[model samples]
Target: MGSLGSRVLRRKAGLPRGEAAAAGKGGKRKRGGAEGTGDSDSDGEAEREERLLHLRGRRKKLKSTSKYIYQTLFLNGENSDIKICALGEEWNLHKIYLCQSGYFSSMFSGSWKESSMNVIELEIPDQNIDVEALQVAFGSLYRDDVLINPSRVVALLAAACMLQLDGLIQQCGETMKETITAQTVCAYYNSAGTYGLDSVKKKCLEWLLNNLMTHQSVGLFKELSINLMKQLISSSNLFVLQVEMDVYTALKKWMFLQLVPSWNGSFKQVLTEADAWFAERRREFGGDISFLESAQGSAFLPVFAHLRLQYIISDLASARIVERDALLPSEWLSSVYKQQWFAMLRAEQDNDTGPQEINKEELEGNSMRCGRKLAKDGDYCWRWTGFNFGLDLLVTYTNRYIIFKRNTLNQPCSGSVSLQPRRSIAFRLRLASFDCSGKMICSRTTGYQILTLEKDQEQIVMNLDSRLLTFPLYICCNFLYTSPEKRADSEAQLDHLES
Candidate 1:
């Protein structure tokens, strides 16, 4: 009897019906033959299976019923078709039920001492729920009163993800991406380079690469600041980005271009010098040279920074477009070269015997001497300036001059040297290019003063006799070349500094 009652209680707890009748009928049964026992056992097994199936069906129905109850209680059955509870419930979901009524709060939290509590609620039919009310409620959750504070952006993202609110998730992600600081970005980079929110991770990668490749602020990035441009180029492997030559080329050109307007008239000079400095370091801390090499093809930045700088020697020697025999107006040249001259003259107005008043003869002689200082060497290297085929071929030396031309390409002609000495030595061009070195024969077109003299302290002018000079003539000139002794002394000075 005791065992029977316990069995009845167990069956009653498990199933709501038939347990009392089964217990009342049960007691003892006599043993029977094998066939009868087998038949009876089969019938019992079938009944047990049926009961299990029924219980499973009931549990499934209960799930659907619970979801419907919560939906109607809180969401007003607006999402009646949505299966909200098939997925495991989140911690905040209980709060959702509690907010609906005191009865749910007491039942769910297991604090049911106050059983008399009731809700003053009106039944809202699913169809009668005003669409505007739902819209306004969701809108309140989505609305922004200010630029969403970056500090709260992550929290908003977590909530959006948990709630499956895609729109809010996207908004928070975009806001965080936009407001991210370099420090924060580096932190994200250190931690596998994502916001840890899966939805934004893909979009964040796109944003980060776009910024790395195109943002103006990339120039200010600390990696670029400390000569770590290579790191950016290499670390981009994290994204499997093939660091193309074009991208690197574009980055380098863009960096130098930003400095252009700041250097003003000397933009080209500054850019070239900057490139040279970068090149030296590049070789020392070597990587692909093609990165800098691509700047040659860049069109956004001017190829030549300062037109006045006649020659720019760069890492890549062949990347220059030089105009030969080009003519520039003397006044324009003077404006560029003598910007400080008038100012200096103005300051010297009161002193009669100022530096400018130094005898024109001496000045000319000294300049010619300086200009010819390098002429003693056979090669006579001059920094090439544009040629003037008109009035005279101008070669810039210590002073400007008009030079006489000579014989044809195959046969060389010699010319008579004319030197006039004043305070400075000046050339009065009545010289002849002889056909033979043996005799100084007079060439055609005499008295053509192809050379002229002018005094600007550091500059020289050479006027070429176009009439005498034939095509492909041998012309030699020099400027800014120091004597071997001077060269050695300068080297010593540099060595001293290095030491």
Candidate 2:
């Protein structure tokens, strides 16, 4: 009886009517044969089968009920039971259709003053909502599906969220996620956060992390907010070009743009202008106050705090730039210099043999960030700069094969090379190719692995399929080239107190 009731309920919902029950009844009778409920069981079975086939074929030919309702009831506003007034626009809507939205459902079903009113004024506090968005939101109540444009999604999302339309909000979120690009990512991220769409926000952040260094632009730098910039700069996942020095350079450029919002200059000219501007500022203040100490630059201190100054000061040229700009306070540079000095002593004297196990926290905070861009399909060999605790690692891309070599000898290199028989390094490698809009088209990653190598030995780290290979590919790497050193008593005490 309960099963039969459920079948009846389904039928009322516009599902296939009694077909399953009729087919089951015919099958049971056929199986019983002599003891069948009816003698024409076989004939009934044949009739039911024919009817089911006819119904299945007619489904494609039938006009969608939602479409009919949307066209006549929504588009034409025929037989509207209610008029919703807001944003200087009036929508002639029906109570039944409006009930699909939770906001309206509660108003009509609950004891609300506006429930009995034929004409209600909607108080829309969100500025993102507009008349067009409201029209789409209301129309969605009369339809089963909505086609959302990426450009219009935020406004529609705002309207849908206000009316508590879950389905429309979800569709808008999906559209935003799918359409994210360099131009739209910041706007989408802000909208997603505003609408409490965490997934879309995450997608935007991932896009930013991947392209922040690899596919940089003046427009993108201008669009990036301080909060977003801090998140990207702090994470080890940042795809830094060349080395951490480039990240610093990018930050310098971004800071300059943030300060001089009206400065319209070429990408090549940004660093020069930034350098000149800061130098001028230093001269203006007679080098008495650091840029970060100044009122205007203090707002940016939080964002700059995330940069791995240890890496920046490790390189002579980058350290010189930091010193020349005086954007950061002397204490910041002194502290980093002291920290790096101690680290160098530990790496040089303590015989740091790279990381043995993957400590995610350590990698996230201290891993060396670097990347390379491949323009064509050919043999390429390159190395990133750092003391690297004598770990002279060379990267090679040849014939769709990527190989990593620990160059102790055989290859003339610039920096110190470790002669250890075997040393381990915790590392992550990511490769991606982007489209013109800076949306990642294809990508691959070797997620956090500890690779041990012998002097002058190589390992085939990754193999690429020629079919999946896209030109202008960006390869990013995070490496922990030295094992953690034991904390001194004073440092441990200081850390404990801070915690």
Candidate 1: segments with Cα more than 4 A from true spot: 1-37, 44-48, 77-244, 249-499
Candidate 2 residue spans exceeding 4 A from truth:
1-61, 64-67, 489-499
Estimate TM-scores for all models. Answer: 0.25, 0.84
Candidate 1's residue-wise lDDT over 1-499, tens digit each? 9987887886546554454554343321112323354355655565577567667867876676666654553446342222222112211122342333333444545755323333222232333223333332233232332245565555444444433455555676677555544334432232222335543444334434334433324323432321223334333111111122223333444455443324333323543554664565456534443222344322322322212221111111211221111112234334533533332232334221113222333322221111111222122323222211111122332222433231123222232111211011123222222221112233222221222322211222344444543322222221111011234865797799999
Model 2: worst 10 consecutive residues (lDDT sum): 57-66
Model 2: per-residue lDDT, tens digit, 1-499?
9988988897676656656676786667676665654567566667778687758745743456557788899888899999999999888889988988999999999889998999999999999999999988998887777889888999999999999999999999999988988888999999999989999999999999988876677888999999999999999888889888888889989998988989898988998899889988899889898999999899999988888887777677878888888999899989978877776666677676778898999999988888999998889998887677678889999989889999987888777776777888999999999887778889999999999999888999999988997999899998887777666964897899999
Q: Please report, in order, the local distance difference test score of every candidate based on alpha carbons.
A: 0.34, 0.86
Q: How many backbone collisions does model 2 have?
A: 1
lDDT of model 1 at position 91: 16
